[model samples]
Target chain A: MTTTLDMTALDLRQVNTRLQAAARAQANEDYVITNPRGSHAMACGLDGPLGVTIKGSTGYYCAGMNKEATITVEGSAGPGVAENMMSGTVTIHGDASQYAGATGHGGLLNIKGNASSRCGISMKGIDIVVHGNIGHMSAFMAQKGNLVVLGDAGDALGDSIYEARLFVRGSVKSLGADCIEKEMRPEHLETLAALLDKAGADARPEEFRRYGSARKLYNFNIDHADEY
Target chain B: MCGIVGLFLKKDDLRPRLGDMLTDMLITMTDRGPDSAGIAIYGDAEAGRTKITVQSEDPARAFADLDAAVSEALGQPVTLTVVDTHAVLIVPDDRVAEATALLEDRGLRVMGSGASMEIYKEVGLPRDVAARFGLRQMGGSHGIGHTRMATESAVTTMGAHPFSTAPDQCLVHNGSLSNHNQMRRRLAKKGVFTRSENDTEVGAAYISSRIAEGASLGEALDGTIRDLDGFFTFVMGTRTGFGVVRDPIACKPAVMAETDDYVAFASEYRAFADLPGIEAARVWEPEPATVYFWER
Candidate 1:
């Protein structure tokens, strides 16, 4: 059965408590939330395979630390959406503000519109796909993840990146230190194709340029001290 | 962090509710900034008259003979209305400068002076400050507010936001300016004087000086992106319009909504949720280094 929660009448704590109780019960139910109206920390810290659909925009830290729930925002989201998420899927129908999907461990975060600055900072393991432009300093200090952008990237894309793979279809303003454009081989194309398919994006795989760490700053080599 | 809000009504039907709506929006952002709060309201202007809003530590003693003294000094009729620690002095338009100087010499610090605008600010919670000023009961065509957390300055009444250094112009900022000291000196050279040590006042003076030099509001905001350093999201009010601009980095959060009746800006979306017909408004984030202004 599907449950409906109207945030206009219910407080955020009560809604989160209900979601947590439902997760503990392992109920195979879906939830529909309406009239969110920019309340922060909605549907956060869930660890079940439930389905949730929010009808309107949300504020900071929405759907954070998710384990196995699928959450969808019908409108835009504020900062830190799906932050530190693990093993789930979060989709935004509209734009996302700064620090979207920051430091997620394992999950799929898809944004249909543009994402603001620091899209995936300090991400351990997550797959982020954006259909529109991303702002400056995205993927900063990202350890392990896959970031795919169909539109242009702002300044300082993937600065101080490590292990994470980045793909951009449009021009990059500038690359961060130790982050460089790598040769897009057939395997990389296959990986990009899979990511695009999972994100339900229409862009072709071959149109993207791959980027990753150059391993020059991995171990603090004395030979590269001058560049530092 | 700080919270900034502005409302410019395009329809006459919503003018009476301007203060009520702006008070609700400012209170919603109490979590972002809880140290101090301020607001500037642009009421209807009367012909051949101008107003100066001043704040004093002791309103009872400072405003007792203010109207009589200023009227005698300027040789014209003057009126003073006291609201808590703030008082508005209405005088003849021709003697506005002389009246302002007289009030300052009598130890009253002018908050704002214009044909339409009046400013009130204090060091307290936004809800308390709004209540103290009876903001919900006042009426205006356009207004702007700020809730400050005391990042770069002390938590004092003079340090609160809605900094106005020019007539009919005031600015509220949500971020810091890295080069305000140097910029303050530059504006001083150009004959724009700033009162407080607050960086936001410098920003206001910069824009006012630029406008004095024949640059439009949009052009002055564009100049800020080139000359000013650091993160900022500024919402300013003039006699007829409201303008918003963000820095090139855009580290500060800002959201705007526009409908048939009004144009509103806030630090987040919660401030717009309770407005009339907000569900149908076109809500969006202002782009970096771009100016958005609305005039009636």
Candidate 2:
């Protein structure tokens, strides 16, 4: 079944209530939130399985805290979309704002367009595949996640990293502490393919280089004190 | 005008003494709130479960009101016992909103609430703040704390750091907003009350109003950043850890150091330096228009 919500006239509260109701209606069913002019918080905090599609751009926290669902934004998303997510698939068709996929534990986040600064920061375990460029501080303080940047990455990528793997296709401005470029293996290429397939993007995995932790922060010793 | 902190275990296992260290660190930053103090720690009581502490001018009256309100709101008798003005409430599960709204509605500002979470201060030196708040010995996982110097507004006990802009959201600020007065006027036009003259409170209100209208913390903050003028180093803590933002060209200093082990922050690097156990911590300045957040 399909539930279409035209948000051109409804306010955010009304939209949220209606969307929540729709999400609670049918498992694995698809619902659409459409607005000729983009508004904020299109799909937030969905706890069950449902496919949500925002036909146009969204403001902030679109598809936040999703669980066992799929959400696709036809246009851009503001800050903190897919934030603190548990599991799901969220695809942003256009450019995205800062802190995308922040603190997310699990799921697949696909940004088909460029992302602003702090993309995927402090990520826990989500797999984020950005087919375009990402802004500064991408993947900063990432604990455990797989970040695939198909284009350039700005400064401080993977700062204070822990176990997260990064793959970038274009130039990198800077690398954060304990983060360094690594050689890509066949397994990594397969992982990229899996991520891209989940994101429904047509990018190839061979174009990117591998990045991971330097393991310097683990088991601190007196010799490594200066880096701190 | 508010501070907040919380901790969430990543792998179903938390670091031993991590919560306690957070408590110690939170108490260290008690200067951020000079009006009151409180802590909430989560875990084994012998180990500790999210400990929460609060300070109030009329501690007895606020406690009485909070107890009654919590009981009325939660359909259970409130029994977070206390001795003197300060007490640690074993906040019942799911009763967080009930207690918080009750305290805030009674005009008692809640600075911090989480594991070893607290908002502690009382017209005293930063060095002596812990002792004054009965935080002589306490510990918990990652939490947040704050200090305040209410300018252009009355320094009443209720007007302290960790100003709750909404239920479960609190923030602290270091610099003034040039457009707060105008923003306040506009917000008033929209039927949003100007609760206090504090710009930080207005800032929190701005975010809360957005959240109520469906703006996530990050989106509301990012969307409104350009609209807000002047300098500010806003430090916000919710049920999560600290969330920070800086103005394009503004006042206030923020130095932070992040590690896979822990992320300790302060207005100045010296505060982290002031921590008894935080040696060899990396510190740096956040870029302008930059936003940072922490989750425990």
Candidate 3:
């Protein structure tokens, strides 16, 4: 069943309360939200297998901390969209602001348009795909996950990164302290192809390059402490 | 956090609704900032006249017969229009220096002076401030409004945003400056003084001083990128246009939307949701360290 939720007629608390209540019920329903009006924290903290679609743009922290619910924004998203998602898929049809996906344990964040600064920071196991450009300091200190960018990246991509796999199809302005471009093997290309297919991106996997940590900063040595 | 809103109209028909549009945009951001509110409007500039906006703690006594007194003292006709606790005094353009000194002698705080710009601000909610000044009824070509949360200064009337330090120029800030004290001392040595201890006032004075030294608006904004340290998203209004710039880190959020009829800047897209034809506007986040300006 598809449920329609209108924001103009209800306050922010009431709107979130109904969504949260439905998520707890695990009804496997589809919810449609209209007149989002760039509100913050819409469709956040869902832990069920529901499908949620926001008709318009949203403000900060949209679809944050989701477990199994799939949420989609038809318009642009504000700062920190899909932050710290445990699992599920969050897709933004338009542009996203700063820190598009930060510190997520698991999930797939697909951005169709550009993402501003710090697109993905400190992700534990999240999979992020950006069809457009990402700003500076993306994938900073990333521990584990796959970040794929099909467009140009701004300054300091993957600063002080670790274990996470980064695939970029375009030019990188600069690399961070411990980040370097590693040769893409067949297994990496296979992973990129699968991610691209899942995100419905039009680019080919072989067109991209990969970046990851140099593994020097994993163990902190006093002599090299400045780099850490 | 603070909220800033700016509108620069490309079409002449939208000029008359400038204040109404800006007031709606400012009020939508009330949740972001509730400590103080201010708005700067660029209205029609009468030939050979400079409008000085002054604020008085006690308007009844301070503004009573003040225009007559200034006219008698300066031997020139001065017209005063009082609204709430603020008043705009129209004086001959050539006598602005003499008139400012005379008004200061009587203890009236001069908010700003320019050919077309008139500023109104107070230490209250944005909604209340707009109503107190009847901002919706006014009209203008371009304007900037600020709803401040008071991070680096006290919540006084003088400590509000939209700080105007130069003629026909005003600025609204959304972030704090780390090197304002040092910059203040540097500008002071060059005879550019700030009236408030607020950090944003120092930023306003810095830009004004640079412009006074013959730097273009774009050059002055670029100077902020090179010189000022800390987070900031500033929207400045001039006689003919407005400019926007953000710090390199861009920790403070800024969203801009442009249509054929107008260009708008807000701290959040929520502020732009109510604007006319916003769905078709080209909305995007401004890149860090980039300067964007629109001139008539």
Candidate 4:
């Protein structure tokens, strides 16, 4: 069974209890948390097929630790929204605060406007798509997964960039360690297009650029000794 | 503890008085290391011949020793002129090691070392260090710098990082050593000279010595992944570009920011805040026992 909670009469605590109760009753049940103004931690840590729809703005840590649920935020969200989320779809109509979807393990995060710094910081398997400009240090030492930025990137775009696919459509002020601009091949173009589509952005994939490691500094050389 | 700053020619086109950038950056970080400063301004590669700047506690005596050592090692009667606390030596690329070893062997403090090729560092802060060294006058394509909060080892020029860990390799470390003593003993057996008691020096030595034995920088880094005992975040720059790694389990903090202006990684995000436009900045923490590699 699906449960709809009108957050106008209920606080985040009640909404959470209802979502948990719904999860206990039906594993596949979805919860729609509605409120005109954004609140904080509206729907978090819900597991199974529990879908969450927040109709307005929300405070920090909304949809955190989520598993398998599809969460949609009608308006903006505060810091650490969807942080360390396991598996789910978190869609935000407006912008997000710092550390959005940080250290996420899996699932997809779609930010419509833009995200602040430490967005998807230390992401593992999750795929994040930012339609607008992103803040500084987008992906520092990210181990795996893909981050698609449709707009210009901030300073230190991928400082000490790891094995993550970073695609930026607009100007990239600077690039991080081992990150170099590469020729966008047909295969890469297709991949970026899909990411944009998933993020609901209007940008064409060709407008962006691809960056990764050059692999030259991976090894040391005496002939290149003077080079360091 | 000290702060370091340098400016590499990010722009492809050559400009006049490029050393001024290093001077500017070094000035910004002067409060980080104020004891003594040095700079070695490198010329364009096509121009040929690398200029080296070095500093020492015993200024006049160190220069004399450096001059005699260079003459003896190269057998070419090299000229060493003392400019304040620094001694300027212009030489070809390959001769750097024999020259450095000879200088160190003769008891020269060797505060900061560099060439038209790359800059090497030891303990000191930014501004006065830059003014004393005059870095804003050189030019190059790529550069790497460091800021240190020294722990466990005596803070001195030698204890400072960006050590010439190998022939042309230099490294900066941010962590404590758990098994520094053992590692030092192991490297010593292989004829790698152990300079200071600092664990980071061992790491630099390990990387350089491994590369000297034909190991790739990445492979050497991976090699140390198993052998070295510590929680650390480290960055090393070679003529090749830049390379960084974190311990399998993070024992320290490191952040990377990429923007339209430049890609910068530091121990804190407060470092990259002012850049103009960017999609976003993200911070990540390495998992326990995870390794990452980046080259430029």
True contacts kept of 2: 0.00
Q: Who wins the DockQ comparison?
A: 3
Per candidate, the number of residue pairs that clash is: 0, 42, 0, 68
Q: Could you give the DockQ of candidate 3?
A: 0.87
TM-score for chain A in each prediction: 0.96, 0.92, 0.97, 0.86
- Give the TM-score, chain B only, in order for the candidates: 0.99, 0.70, 0.99, 0.74
Best of the candidates, lDDT? 3
lDDT of 1 by residue, B1-296 (tens): 99998999998888889999999999999999999999999998988899899999999999998888887888877889899999999988888888888889988889999999999999899999999999998899999999998877799888999999888999999999889999999988988889988899899999999999999988988888998888799998999998999998798999888898899999999898899888778878788878989886
Give the residue spans of candidate 3 off by over 4 A: A225-228
Candidate 3 achieves a global lDDT of 0.93
Put down candidate 2 lDDT per residue, A120-172, tens digits, no spaces: 88999999988888877889889888998888998788988888899888999
* Model 3: fraction of native contacts: 0.76
- Regions of candidate 4 where Cα sits further than 4 Å from its true position: A1-228, B1-10, B14-53, B64-84, B92-102, B110-124, B257-263, B273-296
Better of 2 and 3 by TM-score: 3
Model 1, runs deviating above 4 Å: A219-228
Comparing 1 and 3 by DockQ, which wins? 3
Task: Tell me the TM-score of model 3.
Answer: 0.98
- Candidate 2 wrong stretches, greater than 4 Å: A36-38, A224-228, B1-296
How would you order the candidates by TM-score, starting with the best?
Answer: 3, 1, 4, 2
For candidate 1, give the lDDT.
0.91
Residue B122, model 2: Cα distance from true site in angstroms? 35
Candidate 3 displacement at residue B269 in angstroms: 0.6
Give the TM-score of each candidate. 0.94, 0.46, 0.98, 0.51
* Candidate 1 docking class: medium
